[model samples]
Target: MKFASLDPASVSPRRSRRLWPWLLLSPLLLIAIAATLAVQSRPLVEPVDGGLKPEEIQSTKDFLRRNDPRRLQASPHRLLRIEERQLNLMLMQLAQRYGQGRGAAQIQLQAGTARLQASLQMPALGVWLNLEARLSQTLALPQVEELRLGHLPLPAWLAEAALRRGLGHLALSVQAQRAGELVESLRFNPQELLLGYHWQADSLDHVLGAFWTPDEQERAQAYNRRLVEISAAYPPGSSVSLALLMPPIFELARARSERPDADPVAENRAALLTLALFSTGQRWSKLLPSARAWPQPLPRMVTLAGRDDFPQHFLVSAVLALEGSGPLADAIGVYKEVADSRGGSGFSFNDIAADRAGTRFGLLAKDAPRSLQALMRVGLHELDFMPGVADLPEFLSAEAFQQRYGGIDAPAYRQMMAEIEARIAALPLLQQANVPRL
Candidate 1:
């Protein structure tokens, strides 16, 4: 009989931080745990029945084929489609690779419960931990209330405590809700977990394009209010990268905009614009050299009363980082230093945040030509290629540069950005490249 080994005491603090999030995010892991714990004291019978249906076999195969990134090898068949004896053997092989000893595990669907049976190995205790868990479909989180280790039953208090702790760590409300919905849609038989998720073709565009819903409308406004409160939290010379992921409210706004029958409120529409700007700016920042200079995006708690805005302030302070003795670095550094010197006030950057606050629906971006040129110099350092000064004469013309890459009004702008990002991704790291041009 195969046994899965688990030694919780060996988990280090650093590993715990990384592993807990991954484990807690996946409901499948929870089910696997429940299935492992529940198989205790259950009779081990030969495979009498329980194999995935033909259609389920096809869908599972298709899911793996699409999701697996490895192109050089042929995709393997789903485990649930195979015989129990073969499945356990495969699990044993996987267990060895993952530092877990082989474990005998099986799932069966009966009387509206997805039951999992397993003989787990507790290496620390040197004991066989047998478990049987019954997973029932409920509106809230699925409970693995019934659990046993060997002939002894696990305390309900212990299981509930663990469940509460696991769920508490998932802070993304929107993602958690989606995960719950995914669990709810699962159809399980002893053989397999049937995913009834209908893939939406437009979902990616709807998210990236800044969609919003009524609830999201409120959230977007809240985001701006938060921005107003926290914009001054850092000092005049300190600046941070706008690294925050697009919030759910923006996605809702995009959906609202696409619907012919629905009209989005002014607040959400404004939020959508701000988020889109923020997302685009953050993306463009990556096309340049120094990525770590972009700190983790400020949290919603600080910016939005839990409602957050896309940052509009060009990071004048960060441009100072480009200064160094190297010819390319010094050129950019001197440009930014000179520009900041000309501004007189320590706060040389424009305060466009307030423009977003009241009824006015707009923001003023600080115009720092020297800072822009400095950043381009950094980008050039990353390339082995130098577009000869004669090949791109507009590189010297300020008006030409602005006309070519300044406006973000047209859909073609997005295509251009995509191309720029692709080109950036193809280049080597700045430090790795030996080009001597500034």
Candidate 2:
């Protein structure tokens, strides 16, 4: 019985040893078998580097081909259909290059009754650029209106160029319509449709050419020149740019021509008043006595007044008097007339008290007769008799006026007088006045 038990134990150990060997070798054995089978079934496998495989490249090419809907052949008369994706991509490139990190939404193109409409939203600027181009005309006159180009942080140079050159997309729309109409209505040489863009600002128009021929360098130079000219003409404190001054200047010019008394001081005052009215939307005619005198004072004022009979003649008379050899003389006469009517003596005095009290000219006091005398002593200076006293402080205190008319070493009082004189001389009537013999 002992011999039988020992024999059974020996058998068990042998089985265990056999199972351990199989478990360890199974993984390695299976891998070797797979490798050997692969080698025998196919040719030796080549090492693949980092590049795409031939099949993968082929698949990419196929995908592009499938997506491309408008693959037009090279032909003289070809109606190329550009897919929305393609247009959007092109616009994306443009926006990336010029826009301030703003992405553009999908562009929509549609055929209208007589034109083509291309619309897109600019995400960066929060504005929509809608281009409606006439497709029927041969010359292709595209009128581009700004639906909303304000939100974009447009570079000044770009803005100026835009004013000069037509906006590219809008121009293209017009050309497309023309081309379409030409294709449908008339027979002519079929040329490739050209696209362009332009800006409404004069500075931009000269700078940014249409897409077909964008002269970027030239436009930039032109913009710089314009900026320099504007700076020189308006040097700080002189006045705003001529463009800003145009409305008032034009109105004054027209009034001078139409009025019987074209008083430069009065005209200047009127111009100022008109400008104030325009800015504030307030009627100031009630502040003056001769609101209805003759030859309407200024066109804008007349527009503001909504009246037919304006003081054009009085303005003309004032202008003639101011322009004559005696501008100060004319002013003095007007002042005296006003003062005398109010029972005040028309005499040059350090202080004049009116007999009558409470009316516009009832009480009179001279704050600085010495300053006035000093200005009058300078033969080149002329002071306005009517409303002339009110602008004295501005003339005295403004640095710009002082720089132009007063010497640097002059006393403050002298500078003030000189500035006042210079302002008076700048008036059209006073400018025409003969220099008094000192």
Candidate 3:
């Protein structure tokens, strides 16, 4: 320590020499910092108006998490769990990417409406462009009102004048226009945004028909009429013909299989049985009056007595016939029981069992090829008393039903039956029963 001369003069020159580069770079560093802040603040939507309660925020978050339309299986009207800040940040990033320069927007929840304010930052010129608007919708027609740009009001008169001059038509999309037309009303509450639509019996048919050419529409109408006739051929308000019911089940199965988000096998099984009950308009709860079909626990493995009279004896028998004894099976039993109680009934358990040799479903269950038997069983299940379960277009009217599933004679119906028959012939039935049926 004594050997080294600690002279201030000597150290000061060395320190100053080392600091020169940083001192020279200080202006660029300050500029960078200023630029970053300016970029972040440009067209910023600050959380200034705090009206939402803690509970409201929590509930809204929960609702959004539970119900996102992006989730295919989710309900149509759902809240998004995303926070306003994050959403604004995303919008800003998107705007920046698109050369809009830090376009930040924010939402403020108010009574029956939301206020949105956004800004665009011109970092080069150190200037900010601001926009303010309120969201107010009529029916499903969402309109952005009170739109202002840089303190200048965007008047309704301007829009009306533009429309009058044919400068631009309302700036509303075709989809928005159609939604406004279709939706009867719209509601926004603390809970969620709800759009109410009135669906007439033939509304869907008419909507679908709109997509078809005149010749195609005529053909579809004729085909649909024929299918309705076939569906209506079932005995009025009694037993469902599983043979006739097979076509819809087949269509449902195909559709279910196409859904990537679903368990197709399980859905197909449940849908088949549910549709069968719908076809006959029968409820499952009453099928077994002595047994508590619903509001009771189902066994993990429901052991069916090795009796051919089984499935025929119970509308849910078809579901019970599935290969596995798991949650799906248990759900089927419970749903079937509930469905029987909720829907229109045609036959008692005993009546269906005894008529095994007489009715089409009974005969199919009794003596048809094992594949067909399994198909019938797998396709049929009890319906649950849930919204939108039995709203099959065909079931709305005999005419509609006939137009969709026109029995064994209709080409689609015939094709489905033939395909199921071929599948049964090709594949062996899964062995589900532990005991042999008598």
Candidate 4:
């Protein structure tokens, strides 16, 4: 029952050998610790000077600054005046050929000088052109209607001549009108149109000859060709024809005629830069898929009061909205009511219904799949997605409208909704809420 006392000398050799192993391992552990300390103590490299030097950085900045769209300003006044002169010349000849009594019918020429004043400050050249075109359209209606109706019974050759002259006049008139509106809407004013007329003799000559000289024609044609090229380059719903036409016309008119700093190449380059920037800004939402997923809520719902003539009228109240507010909400309500009143026919919310609340829907509603295909085609070819329900509300025919709006054929709504969902899934977590749930 007595406790046994153990002596250090009697310990087993195996146990003593284990202690030796620990002693031996101490140096290795110390070495590992030393290595870690050495590693941690080492100085971190300054991120290998990846950035440019101050001077180089500044030089690049300077290059970008020099090439900025804002720096490429041309006198909108001069451009407008030139446009006006060209338009007047074309109109006079049209009146001579197509007026009711040959040149006897009074030819009235009015330019939207006020509108042109506003165009001077437009940030984008394309918008300016649209404004000009709108102005011209308003002005040419009277002359165009006169020629079209009056010249109907003339001989074929003479009729053709009249038609061409009338068309030219109408084109110029519309272009000028649109330009003026665009300038006014954007609130741009360059005050360049107020200068002394260096091209006074040229203006007189243009008025005398209904057509541009070959040289002038070539310049205008080249500009138009560029516009065609640009329009073709963008995807469906991404280009505006009027926008493409403005910059070059401005540059060409300024270059061809005597003007200060008559550098055509520089002017052209500048015009191109301005156009690109403006177009990018305007179509940025359409061009970038990421942009579409962001939902902007409208402040309030819109309601349009019923009108006797326009039972189905609607308008775009906001360019991009999360919730409708002000006029936009009212517009949306009007559009929805129009759509709902049709009772499933192919007519859009903008189309007039035979009955105020009829049950007759269009072909598109009958065959959604077919309608979607037609709508896609319309989106691709006609409106280019830039047009809302308000613009070009009618299609090729009522049938076409039925097919486009109500058909809903290819890429079925469900499929499109799914795709949109997938796209939303891929977005950053914060942006997911913006995607509309179908």
Candidate 5:
């Protein structure tokens, strides 16, 4: 877990600000809380059947393979196959995450129907809320045959309505709903399930906007717009280095930081987001649709170590870490390189190095924003954050990749990864105070 230091001066005032909202909404809040308590008053199903078994968990490589980045640009329709064991393991992982180690989830698939069951522990009330949803036919076009909350079976529509209402208050529900709409097909078998989806980019900015205030959104947009201007100054098709933009952008952040009541972390996050996206050849409109009206970012071959692909791997992973989790970003990075080995550019450890660098930089910007700001106030050299690409292996075919390094869990792969990690740790940028090696 992580923690934030509390400010004594702000505690009372923050509590004071919070009182009005709670007081005004007390009636609705109480009603909702009461309804929830009534529905989950007792355990309808056995709670915590089999604890999460480490032996039953899927291999980490299998987990990593799910984040393949090639899916981002693949055809609209795609299929994913999972067996019963994998599904249950995935559920166990999810329950551990959302159920705070006190819950369990299991799915039993057979014939044309599936049964999904879950039990969650209520805080301070020691009660287990059990639910089971029965679905017939396809998960893509889901048909809810039965819905049970605790021991009470309810009409499908009633449960659907209740769920819709409950989902409105969840912070990530919008993203989840948007993502679910992309499912294209589903087939359930006695032993396995086949799930297919359309690959469409969901605007993460829109998803994250749920947490940002209007002012924060506008501030991020301003940085994106500045990047457009920065791109315009360079010639199209020529090489553009992120070095050209980082210092200037962070200087803007520093200026904003000097203003009263400004949050240095948020400022630094916005600047990093802008730089990473623009340097990667991505359209700003993808970040925010209003960016469509902004000047076009001129085309340039963003290069590091004289290779155009390095920038894409680096900046993309950086921004992923900035907005998401570091482990997730790292796994996705590996997936990209693995996908490349399959008849694309082949695998390249150099690119992996770049991806690692980006992840660390993103983490630094996220966890040590004030320290990042102080460094940016001075200047940035390419070598500080992204040092020289070592003489690592590159451009190996799939067969060669497997023969030489085996899989990601192989000792050879891990040794090379360790070398890459050490290189990143030695960078002058990460060497600075408060900067961490991811």
Candidate 6:
């Protein structure tokens, strides 16, 4: 059979017209394509080494605590020093907190300037927004010398204009103004930045308080006070079952939720924060310096299944899971255990199980914050979130871990992991979170 061919006379004029429109659109279309290609599908910046380390977190807290204008006065001659790593750590914390755990930041200092590079994922488009900025000092005040977005290098004048525009926008925000008043100067070194600040009374408070809202602060303080009350009878240095402590705070959350204006998510978040802080043997004052003056939380070793380490692993990981992602929470838990195996207390699958349980609890908290608060109001037990851990291996040194389980990719290690996942899957409380099988 022969194929039929269209005659010139039979061709539609509409098709010809569409071809002309494409010519008209070619320039824009090409530019759009280029931009899309330039913006990477994967994040460009390398993550800070040892993602969210404890010492870095403590450094962040200590920095805030020392410079808290409400509590301490700054000296005119003294300049506060912060490491490049600390700045990056704070950036990572902000990324995890607000970026859905989808960004990384790195600062490379050179003499008097810093090369700040960061990347953030725009999930809706599945593209990363890469940013690079050259920061310099002008009369001890921080200033931007250049800025680049994605693959496009903005002109120096345009960067200056953008910086001016940014400063103007920041001026409109009262919180920014308060924060700005505290920045007197910035001098940079290869590895650190020196900051000079005026003694602006309450400036730090105003700035930090804007983030830690008064309403949220009340929720946090209320939980902390109630927890203090619960810890009082246990004696200062004695151990308390996390089981015994969870009920009263969550019951308070439920009671609060009955009110028409109660925010269940916020309630649960506050409760988790309070409990995690207590379980980890930390105080709310770590973040909010003013809280240092609040009623002291009684010293108590909170335990899960009579093991103190379990509560720290569980509750803190739960908090991370609530704020970040399950994978991040899980990775952090594993990282801690692996780190321990190297030299610390030795690797413990028992603690890993607790971490997995806490992660599930946190995942559920994220999925249905109110439902979790409502469900946990009555009672909590080890069996509710965690399965039996005594049979699991613990206190294994790196050599021992290698000798027995091989490694994480090995069959033995994977079998143990599957067992842990199976145990977590069986938890009714975690089941309510609609956890996806890992």
Candidate with top TM-score is 6
Off by over 4 Å in 6: 1-42, 46-98, 151-183, 188-211, 228-239, 280-283, 289-300, 325-328, 377-379, 406-415
lDDT on C-alpha atoms for all candidate structures: 0.36, 0.31, 0.40, 0.31, 0.72, 0.77
Q: Who is ahead in TM-score, 4 or 6? A: 6
Q: Give the per-residue lDDT digits (tens) of candidate 4, residues 65-99.
A: 66433344543322223233333333332332232
Model 2: residues with Cα > 4 Å off, grouped in runs: 1-74, 103-106, 113-146, 151-438
Reference-based TM-score, model 6: 0.71
Q: After superposition, how far is residue 425 of candidate 4 from its true place, in Å?
A: 49
How much lDDT does candidate 4 score? 0.31
Answer with 3 or 5, whichever has the higher lDDT: 5
The runs of at least 3 residues in candidate 4 whose Cα sits more than 4 Å from the true structure, single-residue gaps closed, are 1-213, 259-438
| Candidate 1 residue-wise lDDT, 99-175, digit = tens | 22224566665434666566545555554556556677554344575765555566755766644553454323444
| Range of the 10 consecutive residues with the lowest summed lDDT in candidate 6 | 166-175
Candidate 5 lDDT by residue in tens digits, 1-438: 889887767678778798889898999997776556446765543444434332333253455467553534566677777888788777765565455455678888988988888877787776677888988885456577898877567788786676676466444466567656666777788968888776645434444334555776778777876776777887766786666667778878878888888887788778876666666667656666656677666766766767677777777777767664566566667776777787788888988899999888877877877677677644567788785776889888889999999977799999999999998999877888546454
Better of 3 and 5 by TM-score: 5
Q: Candidate 3 regions off by >4 Å?
A: 1-101, 123-125, 137-139, 142-145, 159-438
* lDDT computed for candidate 2: 0.31
Error in Å for residue 43 of model 1: 13
In order of lDDT, best first, we have: 6, 5, 3, 1, 2, 4
- For 1-438, candidate 3 gives per-residue lDDT tens digits of 369877867778779899899998999998776554434334545321322222333444455566433443533333233445544444443333233224456666544676666666666777676666777756554566666655456675454343344222322343244434556654444434455554444343334333334433333233233334544554443344343445454454455445565344444444434443433334322232222233321111111232222323333434433322122222233223223333433112222221221222222233332333335444343210001111112112334324565522468645643443332232222223122222
Q: How much is 264 displaced in model 5, in angstroms? A: 4.2
Is 2 or 3 the stronger prediction by TM-score? 3
Best candidate according to lDDT: 6
The better candidate by lDDT, 5 or 6, is: 6
TM-score of candidate 1 versus the correct structure, residues matched by position: 0.26
TM-score of each: 0.26, 0.18, 0.25, 0.16, 0.61, 0.71
